[model samples]
Target: MEHPALIIVDVQNDFCPGGALAVPEGDQIIPIVRAWAEDFFRQGYPIVTTQDNHPPHHISFGERGGPWPPHCVQGTLGFALHPALQLPPHAVCLKGEDPDQDAYSGFEGLVEGPEGHREPLASFLHRASVDTVYVAGLATDYCVKATVLDALKAGFRTIVLRDAVRGVDVNAGDSARALEEMAGQGAEIR
Candidate 1:
């Protein structure tokens, strides 16, 4: 069996319904993600959660002149994880906390900081002996896409659970195009 790691990316309140940057029907993925998490937990596979922990004045928010609205602010109710997806001990990986940076990929922060880089994923998977990674979470057009791309670049076999993700479809075909791009990059979308 391929040694697999389940990478849950950015299932935060800010990406769900009634959120600042809410994707259409984003909460729809919660049940699916929860089910997958349960399966991974039962199978004893390694699981890692990626959180978009942005500061209050994050550059990715409109308050900071970003196109998007305020969201995922650090230490706010908007930053909380989805209620349905259970987080076990040590499964969390936080990023995008720097108000100046915007990190979409779980493997690495978007912009570099002076406090030395934080790459918890590469070492975590290597130490856990994970050869393949199953990725699922919100905003397929953004963070989910970045995470899968980085996973492939890291030389890990990658799979994106299509049913367990939602996209920030700004336009009509944004989500579809995003999926196509990811598939073209050798990501198995299921």
Candidate 2:
């Protein structure tokens, strides 16, 4: 039978409050995400996570003329996953490792192999027989939205855990608009 998985996108420290690029109330989702993960874990469903791992001079950095402040740099505390957010054994996909890749979508990220090789998001899910994916994470306007859209494009039934998300809201209503866009693209906000 095809299994369903949970994709926890970009829940690292930097996206939380009191970090270099904190999302407003981003830390609020931890308990909800943890509860969902635990439920999925108990059911033997796979839990996949995404991290924003970038170099100091990543192209998305404002120092490099990109829009946002420096955050989630590789090897920094900001790059660490939120401490309060616990998980069971899960696959981790690291995004933005390459300087040129914005990698907003977890679909654009990769997971490590036994030999230190990397695997793409869709490939891993397909290999694991995952037919549906539920996404919950930071910045509804950006990473979460991108991941959900890509999941749909890759032909996976996608669901967005509405209460388990927060957004940077660079603009006043970007988060609301993003939810609409995701819903418009066939992703259900549950």
Candidate 3:
């Protein structure tokens, strides 16, 4: 596809091993994404890295009656991206910041792109003339899946880098099911 952008979703400390909402082998995708990010950056393609930065009382928190434990909380180390991921200077998107809403898709997040101002991901991507989205990063069943679905709905040619993803699998085989569902919904699983 032409004008492809790389969307790395929620590769944060909290989703890695030993953190609050660890995804199995989640950190394992770091090198894969790092390599891809470097290539995309060198190619002058847009690279968008995402974070799940949430307020302490975010609606998705168990403390607020949601199923998930308070994770990726603002100002906490868990909210930070993993040190080893080494992404280039690219757009940064923040999700789960709204205390009243739980955002899983990067499309729902706001991007702090080269403009140095926040705008919706879809708008930023569109402004960049992005016609395709190549996705990577954590939790295949959750954020990655959600991002892919949204990208397709937004009418972009969406592709998932299967080698660069892992999942929490809150339920057994959820990750596998997510990939199938995404493909079924028009996302190419590469």
Q: Write down the lDDT of every candidate, Cα atoms only.
A: 0.83, 0.93, 0.92
Weakest 10 consecutive residues, lDDT, candidate 3? 109-118
Over 153-186, each residue of candidate 3 has an lDDT whose tens digit, in order, gives: 9999999999999988889999999999999999
Model 3 CA deviation exceeding 4 Å by range = 113-116
Name the better of 1 and 2 by TM-score: 2
Of 1 and 3, which scores higher on TM-score?
3
The digit string of per-residue lDDT tens for model 1 on 28-52 reads 8888888888888888998888888
Candidate 1 achieves a global lDDT of: 0.83
Clashes of each: 0, 0, 0
- Lowest summed lDDT window (length 10), candidate 2: 110-119
Model 1: how far residue 43 lies from native, Å: 1.1
Alpha-carbon TM-score of each model against the true structure: 0.91, 0.97, 0.96
Query: Pick by TM-score: which candidate is best?
Result: 2
* Model 1 misplacement above 4 A: 88-90, 109-119
Off by over 4 Å in 2: none
